[model samples]
Target: MQRLTVFLCCIWIGSLMYGEMVAFWRPYWKCSWPPLQQNLTEVPHSHEGFKVAVITDPQLTDYTSHGLTPGSFAVKAIQFFTDIYMRRSFRTSLLSFEPDEIIFLGDLFDGGPYLSDKEWKESAERFEHVFDQTQRGSKSRLTGIPVHYLSGNHDIGYAGFHSHKREVIERFEKVYGETNYRMKIGSVEFVIVNAQTLDGSMNENSTSSSWNFIQNISADANPLPRILLTHIPLYRPNDTPCGAYRSSPIINQRISNGRSGIQGIMYQNYLSEDTSARLLDLIKPILVLSGHDHDQCTVSHPTPNGPVIEHTVGTFSWQQGNLYPSFMLLSVSALSSSTTSNPEGIVSTNLCFLPMQTHIYLWYASLFIITVFLLLSWPTSGVDLSYCFRKLTELAATAIRTTSKGGVKVKDEDANYEYDMVWDAEGVMHLIRKGYSKLSNANHGEVRSSARGTVVARPAAKKQTTPESDSSCVQIESETNLEQIPKGPRMTKGKMSYIVQRLFRTLHNIAVLAAVNLPLYMMLLIKDWT
Candidate 1:
């Protein structure tokens, strides 16, 4: 307990002592990690007071949904989200920041637009009430502040991703009044990015015009500052040469020398991932604001020196999984409402910050190191080893029980799987087609289902893979009646039992590690004591 207290104290002090700096380090921090900057030119226009405002994750789900669900998230459905990140809270937070404008990072709803048309109506109603108050509040601000928003993975996932962004723009415009547009306020060139551009996989043609517009603005502008707004982080912990978006392909070719799709940029690029780099290099904006993850953390990347900041917004919905809700306030200043006046914002310059990284990697490493030492000392220190031995035995039993004699668990023929895409159109369609599997279960000609839920059995299903009547592999003999097909459970509940077994196995492995490390730790301790 004493040691634990020390550990906690270290963390508290570490956080306060942490500072911001440049992201130009060999390893950049995750997007929100270090608020670092460099090569930035903050030239001020003669605007009034400093502009600061707040933006948070307001996950206002459709009232009917109440943000409830089944799946890993089903467990979290008991809580009402609207009460958690209400617009009033956002209003109060903004009022405190007293900035010129407030930008929402997205996930306006839990993500889905409802399988049935009826659901959309409900979601629409709840969403309107949440956003309307804010729109009205913006008008009440001393500056009659403008409110901006960026689409997140959840906002358009139900609409087939970028494909339906335009279709939903009207709905959003009705609530918040726009999808992608830009304006210049007191020298700051604030460009609101569309949702599609953030997804690295988006087709280039869709984003080309947006980029061209910004380039034109940069060419004509003078001493004004630049700011780009969007949701989802621009970088990850694992980043190679692949910089954010525009800088990615350049980095890809440079790193793999033509090889593509190696590993997730989480470790490689750290937070300096794809698409984001392009927006940074092209826009050269002094600030970028985004959201997705629910926690509030600021990483001062590249340097351990002075004050630099990258704004990361927080979550708004309480029902989301592991995602937190929060907002930020940014001050507006020094120019005209028109884009022509100040080229840059009233303030811009070289950034500085000192980073005291939590380094979760090292945190876990130390825990393992200590655990190993404890394991080594346990037996000789006269502590019972049965807990340790029992754990190992249980793990081995789990490994044996889950595996098939030949080794390989198979999926049901009718398992419904969809793309890893934040967009789950087919999943929504399937939900709408509820009991389609059960109805067809009696008729084996189509997919099959059973009494138990083994919800998504397939690894991934692509839009292109939907079976068409003309498929060569499927026979279409008019003589063969569809009624003569076999029907049975696609898969049994027995298969999912593997989860319990897997857990035990993992625990067993930890026990083994402890057992192996115990003796070494005790030896060192005894030597010191002697």
Candidate 2:
């Protein structure tokens, strides 16, 4: 039993410590762990598998008010604390994934609606600093990965609410290029759409042009596996609201009338009733991806072409509903051209949630486990609970007195100052005394000399005492005098067993402490990273 206990403790301690070290190293340096791979429906075309990192709703901002006023400083201070350092963390995590390409599905800015002329320019500059390709002799957070940006409700405008002017749309297009565009990578056609356009918030001409482009692409004689990327998900599928609907199903049902009573930005943030059906019929996109709800979810709908799967990726913003920052890694295999009727190649997607808050849960779990282990492994004979409590109280008092004096103060009376006495279950009262200085100076030779022949004499107490109690109460003559003390009796078989048990209990306590505190301490060191 002892061997097994020791072995288990070693394993637990080793695992906890190793996890702590990795966690500590992760925040300062990028993690080297491989990205998780998720498998999708297999396509008929033969092609090599490639990785795509999908990040959304970073909503990056300096967070200060858009004015040159005194209050801006206060607002900036508040925003500083609230900012999750999304850029730094995102870069670190993305580097770890080492994706071939990155696709950001919208809401790249939080204060887009409030931006002034200067603020707009600054926001554009900040966006480029964080996401744009590296220039000559410049540092780039993205290394060499190609990035595709999409416009969400926060960027330009939704539909009817917080609508942006035509000039604002022009500026966005100028910076990020056409919001609605298509790119062919390998045998796959990625269709990027501006959900804002569908809401009738943008110029009708631009919207019409995009629609025409999509139609033109769909008319291809040899179409590839189409994947659509947008900001808002299709109108609530499987009765699960992913867009601007209220979190509660009952509330959503009450508010969602025939036309969806949601007004303005919220309305534009979600698709209209027949929006998905129309898009599905037009493009026949097998896979559709979106973001803007900040909720990670997946739903499938059957169409004339095949099954269309829609996924809403989670957010990296703490300002949003993203309690834990996360992103998706998409793995797309090469398309096989054999018997191609728009080959449905397998596209695997893994939603990788960051382990930022995992340490908190692990700390709580470790504490609970340590408490249980201590209770079950405590030495009952050598350590008395009441005695331990008393000792702890006395130690606290001594510490308080020592701190007040700036150092330990020694009393003149008999070198050892008596503080208090504690009576045990055996009716034997042990007088607690302290003579820290002399105790430290006394050597083993002195202890042996004192034990050999020294005997102490003191005034007899004015209380009844038994013969064994009198023999046990041999008072010390001086500070160095620690005469042969009575420890109840010699070591018998039972006493030896008790000693061995206490030894094991001590080891158990040490092991349990290591298991409980190592990870917690490491977590404290990294809690400020993100």
Candidate 3:
């Protein structure tokens, strides 16, 4: 048991040290591992160097207050906590990357269809607080950073339907301004396309306008390296044989209607393959950034002009469908100041997956329980109780001894009483024998001193000495010392308590290791140690 305890102790201590080391390198852990590094040699741009923080499908929502039914508060509380964590993590990642600007590629709110005018304003306020740095009284972690917003099907209904009403669109415009806008950073031009409207879901006229806008940008007289920013990725050739790009959102009972049943066959989240191919041909964009599917993917579709690359980033929020949280950082550098005519520049994109340490929660909970158990498991001393029991037994034996002298005795029917008394009496006798040995040694020493020149008979000296009286006196003295023997037992009890405390501490450490999955980290530490 002792050896096993010591070994577990070492593991526990090592686990703590390992935890501290990881915490110290937390920033690196948050950004670097599981990173996708790609140099977009196809992208044409020019700059000293600029970084764009690309995050998609934030889908931020306060689901806690949504559908307020019985026992919904717990779900709401959890959602609230998750929202806070995700927002903070997103902000931290952006700051870590030090992006010049940020692009939120849609579904900034989960219930865009259901949001009232007031709710829309509130959601917009939260968006500004989390993502926009210029807003006053904002909790924006990044200052002086500009953010571009894109509209997803969740924000407004699909192109071919009125499921998302015009009033909802009006509310959205009040907060985020126009859905489709353009911006130029460095030598590159970014054209934001409203995919929801581009699909002709609201009206044919809106679709025609979006198409015309794309055409105008594609036919720019002095076109720079143009990039398309939208919420849905263009369909790949293999997405489906018949023409739809991918599966649609699950139609649950709450949102299902007369027109919703067969909608899965016509995916609302993805653009048509034909439209995608046409857009690629027209713009001849080097890179396309999009997000609607929570999965991260990069697909290259061959166009008549060239191959257009679409990089879809994963969701940064916590949800049932979100497998892992991720974002992309696009870096652009200018070839030269005079490269406005020749806007081909170096572009590198790194897709970063945030570390998801879900096991740490379990580890913390386990440590707390173990600590509480150890505190309650403190060793207790039963000295007073044992001493009282011993005194009672001694008294009973003394009564029997005194009565035996009179040839009379009380009936002692307790079977174990006699056995216990016998053991106690034997212990007293052993002490008496020890006292006698000590007295004998003292007498022998005195005889040796008195008879240094002559041989002295130790037996004669023993006989001359009245050892009966001496024995009686020594026995009384021994009894007095025995009366104080409880102190020795008390010291022994303290030693036992100390041992128990050490054992509990060791157990606590082991519990922590088990909580944190010690074996995995132990291997990591060993590898690093070597």
User: What TM-score do all the candidates reach, one by one?
Assistant: 0.42, 0.56, 0.57
Candidate 3 regions exceeding 4 Å error are 1-47, 64-72, 132-142, 161-164, 201-203, 237-267, 335-344, 357-530
RMSD of each: 28.9, 17.5, 18.4
For candidate 2, lDDT tens digit of each residue in 468-529? 21123334333453466535555476688876776767666666656766676556335533
Ranking by lDDT: 2, 3, 1
lDDT of 2 at 418: 21
lDDT of each: 0.43, 0.60, 0.58
* Residue runs of model 1 more than 4 Å from their true location after superposition: 1-50, 62-81, 91-93, 96-99, 112-118, 131-145, 158-160, 163-166, 173-175, 198-205, 221-223, 239-274, 300-309, 321-325, 335-530
Mind sharing the TM-score for model 2? 0.56
Residue-level lDDT tens digits of model 3 in 1-530:
33443454565555455442443234445553222122345334332367787888867665423555523676556555455445545554456555788888988887676667666677666665555343223445557777778887677655444333556666666777777778887556788987876555323555667788888877777676778888987765444222122223322112122255422212355677677877887777778888887767677778776676677787876552654567787766534324333223435566776534344445656755655554445334313657889999999998889878884644433311100011122233211211232223233221211111322222222212212322321211213446656687789999999878767665665575465656665565443322
* Model 2 RMSD vs true structure: 17.5
Question: Least lDDT summed over 10 consecutive residues: which range in candidate 3?
Answer: 415-424
Per-residue lDDT of candidate 1, residues 387-409 (tens digit): 87999999888778767444555
Model 2 CA deviation exceeding 4 Å by range: 1-48, 62-71, 78-84, 129-142, 161-164, 201-203, 241-266, 337-344, 357-530
